[model samples]
Target: MAALMTQFHVSPSGDDSAPGTEEHPFATLPRAQRAARESVGAVLVHLRAGTHVLTEPWELTAEDSGRDGARVIYQAYGYGTDAAEQVVISGGTEITGWREHEGRWVAEVGALDTRQLSVDGQRAERAGIDGLPDGTTRTETGYRTTSLAPQQWQAPASVEFVYRGIYPWTEARCGVAAVTHTGEHTEITMAQPAFDQAKALYNYEFEYQRLTGPALPTRVENDPSFLTTPGTFALTRSHPDHHVLHYLPRSGEHPSHTRVVAPALETLLRVTAARDISFRGLIFADATWLRPNRSQGFLHYHGSGYYEGGDIYTEVLIEGRQWLTVPTETATIPACLTLEHTAGITFEGCRFTRLGGTALGATAGVGLTVRGCDFDTLAASAITLTGDRDAVLEDNLIQHIGLDYAGSPGISLLGTAGCTVAHNQVTDVPHCGIVAGPGTGTVLSNNHTDRTMGVLADGGGLYIAGPQGDSFDNGALVRGNVIDNTRTPYNFGLYTDYGAAWVQVQDNVVGQADNSAVLHVGPPLDHVVFRGNYWNSDPVGSDAVPAGVTYENNTTLTDTDELEAASSAIRARAGLLRTQEPAIG
Candidate 1:
């Protein structure tokens, strides 16, 4: 099924007065979308050559058909040509009410499409911009947006003291800048006050009647990792009468001191409800923070498929330095995008890199499929899933993950059912390549891992942590996986935690190991079997002759200490009474 044809074109010198035809096209995308929605079958909206500045999003609506086989499609005509570059709809800049002053346009800083600085109605001097050798201009500089003004330096009589400078955990403390709370509604804005002649002034709310001592009970110092100061403030403010006291921070200081803050998970969920929305071709540098100071999942949709196509290059250089010195903070910073609580969602042909947090984070989805994606240089885990059902993760390349955190895994699966992790390449991560945790009817098959740059922490090709709940029937299968040079700081090629029963480990390959043993099995349940796996740790080849579970035709190359250890772990897990239990319990 298709909607009626709605021809809409955009040009730099066009207006709405023009008819929505190929010759005389509608100038605005909203007009085109509106006209297309009113059509009967389908509307093919075409955008002509030029740039179109948009203040809001343009959403297209499809008409509903009576039968199942009917569908509506809105096709773009000039998507493949430089002439196809005819339409450019942009937002995030505010320019209005500006007259030509000194041969320049004057505009307010309402929104910014480009980073050019402007004065009262006209473009003014710009920072970090210089003329280049080829007569091109470049913006090679950035501003420190986190700095505070100079007047807020002195400490006030009463202040919401946050000392996260250094040694934050031991020195956390909070207090009311004054004895009173004042603001419109629940807001409190305080001014400079006298507290031992400290110039720091605060504006805040104190909901409670009074307290005998300081607002919070902790102290402060100068160190990194500031998890405890806010923890103490929130602890003291748990009472109903306790309220937030606002404090205008000193110059170059933020109002709040949290290491990571991200857009609220709900905002992402709202964006996920649309169809054919793609992030692949856009340069997203300065999007506003829709939500701040919370940790939540990214996106969620109901039976709607999500699409993302894009690339991210870390503007900050991390050659031989710490990565977190940049003031930018996001709690669950997704590289490309995230999809949660969805059905029939698909991710294809995307690139995720230089991420602040996870590359792809998913949870509680059904009929999900991810294909032909590349993940690299992620600060956290590359791909993570939780509580998913009937998902397929296939044909992707994942590498260089956990660059910021040494304990992070490449892929973590928690309570996912009837899913498959297949045909992917994983390397240079800090933890396990694939971890299946307490899930039923899951499969890890035909995946390859390069152990040359193996993770320093525990876990390798596949890690199984089970028995978290009774819902796990141990119907998990691990087969046809390849591991090479996987040097872990702690444990195995395949690790099994508690309640690992009726699981199958077969048809896999392993190359090297570190201090820990390979094929770790612990706190067994019923029939955790290992069979038909190959090993090549020593000069003589050996078969995978695991002792504990029922062995099936498996072989190895050059029996070594690792092979013997694997055999012993199988025996111990098989209840054969070990000489000594493996360290992993």
Candidate 2:
């Protein structure tokens, strides 16, 4: 006979040698998982109210999957009760032992390789350039500056230069190779030039011109001289095996009283090829991620260069000249929660906060759902779902994401089919809000996005693209979304670019966009239908609304009262679920 359903318990004060019962719980999730692996049928692991520090990933592989209509659930102990408590699963190490040094606080963290630090549950700033450089002149190779002394630029080779070009939308980070002085100018050569200068198109607009050229105005960071501001920190290695943190504490904040932490692990949970697993009511926090520096290149395909009506197509070129643009690099950055080749996995009512990389990621999964979760203060993208089938991301609140990396979106869906992205509020992101591409049967509805593309350019609140030949016969539906406050120079509220076809966009309210309210660009803009959309601002310079587009029932609001009413109604219907409530029955 098969074993009966099993229940395992984990707590911070429990012992691993216990029987994993309500009274005697295991100490860690991995120990409970080990006990669950030895059992059969259904298994549920209850995590009590406490902090669980993860020194390594809590991996759930295929062998640990539930069988025969059973599921493996990891949830809070009192999940549905009023007494439900907070369960924190952290991937960082708390630091103690502070001393004063020259009006600053210093701590010895001992070989922790991280760039992110948190104090009292707030993300502290990394030391960066205080202001703009003194002077920047374009060079044949890279750029020359008269900003700092030669010794001030002699940071380690790992230091990078973040440059904001002539356009607000154009930015790049390149590694420094050597910093030397030529006459009166300090010449800095990059390991790899941000972009090829020879391939730049000179006669294009300023926005397009920066995309094809070399670096513009630049600011170098991570130098020791910039570590003067309060709540800013720098990590220095004085010995081969020891690392120290130099911190400028804020007023009334001291190391002895503050809960200071630095990220130690890259991933908190790794579900690999598992099935019938669910994680709910848990907090995942404080994981580090380093962006890999590889041979990255961009390709700018000028439509005027090819044909008469071809628009400028700028994409991250990977290998060939086939006009294929890859999504933001995912294989290099680590995430807090990674689900790879997993099926029947769900994350409900969970919290992912203060993470250094992407918060949640799923690759090649089926029957995946991320519902009623909160993703905040993330360094990279909030959520990325790729090559998944029948995926649903709904009723989630994502804010303050993409704080460090500007290339990623708040939510990105690539090669995902039959997916529903609805009722989610995504705000205060640096790049796009909801980016769905190269997919079919995707329904994006009732999602509110605000203040997106705030720091970067050339994106939108709702951005969609596809391959050249796919017909989108499944008919992607983008309806009832509220896109507001897209303030970047070239960012649109709703953008369909590069062969997006056979999609219906309806009933969305777009307000206060820098670019057009709805923009259609690139080639093969076939069978895109826009209906019943309310534009709160004038769409003045949009010319890519092709002749065959099915544009009908769209309205432009001139009255303030009507625009405010429409915007308020849309927000009320598409608002975020900040607290736990009953799921839609």
Candidate 3:
């Protein structure tokens, strides 16, 4: 006979004060956790099918860990017995009391400062403008509007303008500082300059030299003047105690028929200093994040535009923070799930969707495994593992990530050793697909990255940047991946930037990249190897592939014989022919 294990049950219809048995379940996860901590042996917390609205994060510490060849398993009921049921742990509050105003729907959501909104499980666009109004002109200080009344520009501090820079593809958002009516034109002063005018590489003459000759296209948002489109939302506070949300519904959507949800919390779960914990078959969704403040100083690149330097630019702020006069360090926007200082933690068959920050973040952990999960519609990276050892991220589907921020990637691994990122599919991101850096012993193989770098330029589908200080990403193997359709400027199918060294890239299929060369190498490379790769395009030559690099048996798209051979080799090595589909509820 099997040894009896301790068990606790949690259900939506139960009460927390009851005994956590199969018949009488606990209502909240915290109560179940407390009971699990008091037990001596292994424990299984079974969650019933329903929605679990969490106002705050469910935290687990070292005391909650399983010990002595035992484990703690938090899983959905009917996981293996029957078909998977819907178990949604949501961080957002459902909004009610919707009415009509000026041919639009209006509601009051108390002081929730979120930029994302969803109606009937679909993301709605924030009210914005596509281009500048006619007769708008630029000045040395800011922009001037020709036909604007004083009432339209009232409360300038709460307004923001998005400017399409001289390059026409690049964009920047600036807060409004002052707005004045000068009878002839309305002058608007920005809190910061719209874009970096001083540091221009290709369009230096048009961007910096001729400042007032032609006005860049601009659009004002976060105000009430431009709330004309359907499926758009705007938040405004006319009084201190009253916050109004204005929304234009789609053609068939109505206030009484649709389900509206606004995000309330940032973090849904936090596992701290714990060991031997597993979370399975759970869905975490609908958390919000606010963008951090920008810095006054700027760091300009030679070819790219100027970048603001502050807490937003660095990765060290992921741990702790200090807010001084200059705000040297700041807190990270919390993820839907955060794991720190933990070991042997596994997240299996889970789904993370509609989150404002990262989906899953593991910092300073050991033996963390995230397998067979789905990460979708996140504002930041899908998975960010830092300072971890022997971490594994496999068989996951990461899509529609970095929707709000362009700098973060789909999967970011930093300062990690003996990590395996394999067999995942990453697509529809604004930045890189898989970015590893400043680490060692990393194996990135058998992944598929497509349609990446849709917004941001100067990145790659598979990218590595590093060798900072004494930390070297030596002996990292990147092989057997399929990357396609990188259309942004300065982007590539495979890129090694900064001081990346001693990496082996082999036996991959790269196709349909916008740049002529599929492989791109930046300066200060050391001991890199490229062998037996099949490119479905022409090589751009020395500009992308530099000297002193080992290149052998690499063929272009037209060589059908070599291409078929290479494809067969890659498929045999990975042991899988196609990507896995995401698990459904």
Candidate 4:
């Protein structure tokens, strides 16, 4: 006979003082977690349908783990009957008591400081202006603009300078310290160290472009002077008592009618040293991070890698080409949900949306499985796995990610072994779709990518680079995947770059990309094989195989009938097996 499991309940309207039964469930997750910690064997914590707003992160540790191979499951108790019924664990506070001031609605948010705001479940644009005015030049402090008056703005110190062109793949952001008017030239001084540090990082540019410094800024944000347009919001914190929020109504929006949410917490969940935990059919939403708003702002070096204080660079040889690589000790845009030193964790059929950072991050964990999830409208990457063993990411719908940070990939796995990323639909991404960095026995298969590498350079649909074990001896395998479209200018469909070796690409399809050059190769590449693949257009990388790369049995379809028949099977087997449930692989 199977062992019986203990169950507890929690709800948005529940009371913590109750008996914690179904009829009298706990009002908060922490209360229910406290109750679960007192139990043994298998346990289930059922979160009823409603929004559970949190004051801090809902955390679980080893003390809350299950025993004897039993699992502690946190799931949605009842959701199938009503499509609108949901279990939302949010890190935002609602804004209310709106009144009209001049032409727009105004609210006195007591002391909330946030970088992201959402109105009616959709992300609202923080007030911004495009670039410095015409006669602007970079100064020792920040900039000198003759057209825009910085001294007269309501919040002088809160304006953010967001810049691109640090490289083709880097976007740097910093906060303004002070603004002053110097006769005809307005001086905007930025926060120290990070501002000067970004200039040094930009000096180490990509090999193609040996540029000087990053441009002044593509845009500037969070100034009340730039809030003239509709559908925009601005915050003025220069007041003595409270920070004021001014929101201009869109064509059909009213602050009193629509819901406005400003995210307050950076992390929604933090699990450490836990085992045998699962989250099912839940929603993790509306979390934001504000570390980038600090003086030491975000300085991105490459994908999933940012330089905080080091200007370190090392030269490496790839396929006879010499290139510079930097240290990626830590990543920028920390995940709203972080799991460290945990094992036997699974998140199934969950939704991660409207988040300001990465959805999920797991490191130093074994047997982590993320399946059948929907990730949308994120500012950073969808999923990131680092130093985890035997992790599986399958059958997830990842779309519209990297909305703010364009260099983040859809899925990134680094420094791992015995991992599988398969049957996931990664679409509408701004950078690479799937990236494998410095791992062994990693299989990236049956996945589908569409319209990837749309904004950044030096990326591809499936960018498999770095050390991938011994040459084809249970090494990394890239097979049965489909690359639908990569319409960007300087990217590829299948990329073997950065001295990646001992990898195999078999039985895949590349369609509707830059058909003239579907494949991309970077030097120091060794012992890589590409065979039994179908392309809609002829790829030009075959002309010169160089020395270590080999191409065999790769077909280019000129005939319509043969192309249609061959591509049908490869496309059918790609992406999710089913929407309701992920098929076991």
- The candidate that achieves the highest TM-score relative to the unseen native structure: 4
Clashes of each: 48, 1, 0, 4
Per-residue C-alpha lDDT of model 1 across residues 1-585, encoded as one tens digit per residue: 543443455454656777777677676766665665565543345555443444443332222111132222322345434433423333323323443333222223221212121122122211111111122111111011111311122222223332121110011123222222123111112222211111111111223222121122122211111112221111111223332211111223222331111111111111232332222211111112211111111111100111111221222223333121111221233433456565555555545544445666676767667666677755556777778888887767778765433445677777788888877777766566777777788887877766622534445566776643333254778777766566644546655554565578776766565422243343444456667776654211123534435655666655566664655433222211112355775
Write down the TM-score for model 1. Answer: 0.48
The lDDT per prediction is: 0.43, 0.74, 0.71, 0.82
Write the residue-wise lDDT of candidate 2 on 264-337 in tens digits: 88888999999999888999998986442221322212100111111334453322332222222223234678
lDDT of 3 at 65: 98
Clashing pairs for model 2 are 169-457
Q: Which stretches of candidate 2 lie over 4 Å from their true place?
A: 1-4, 130-132, 136-150, 153-158, 165-170, 177-213, 237-240, 292-333, 467-473, 538-545, 566-571, 577-585
Highest lDDT model number = 4
The TM-score measured for candidate 4 stands at: 0.93
* Per-residue C-alpha lDDT of model 4 across residues 371-448, encoded as one tens digit per residue: 989999898999999899999999999999987788899999988889999999999998889999988899999999
Sort every candidate by TM-score, greatest first: 4, 2, 3, 1
Show model 3 residue runs off by greater than 4 Å. Answer: 1-3, 134-142, 149-156, 163-172, 191-219, 292-334, 468-474, 516-521, 542-547, 558-585
Candidate 1, position 213, lDDT:
17
Candidate order, lDDT descending: 4, 2, 3, 1
- Per-model TM-score, in order, reads 0.48, 0.86, 0.84, 0.93
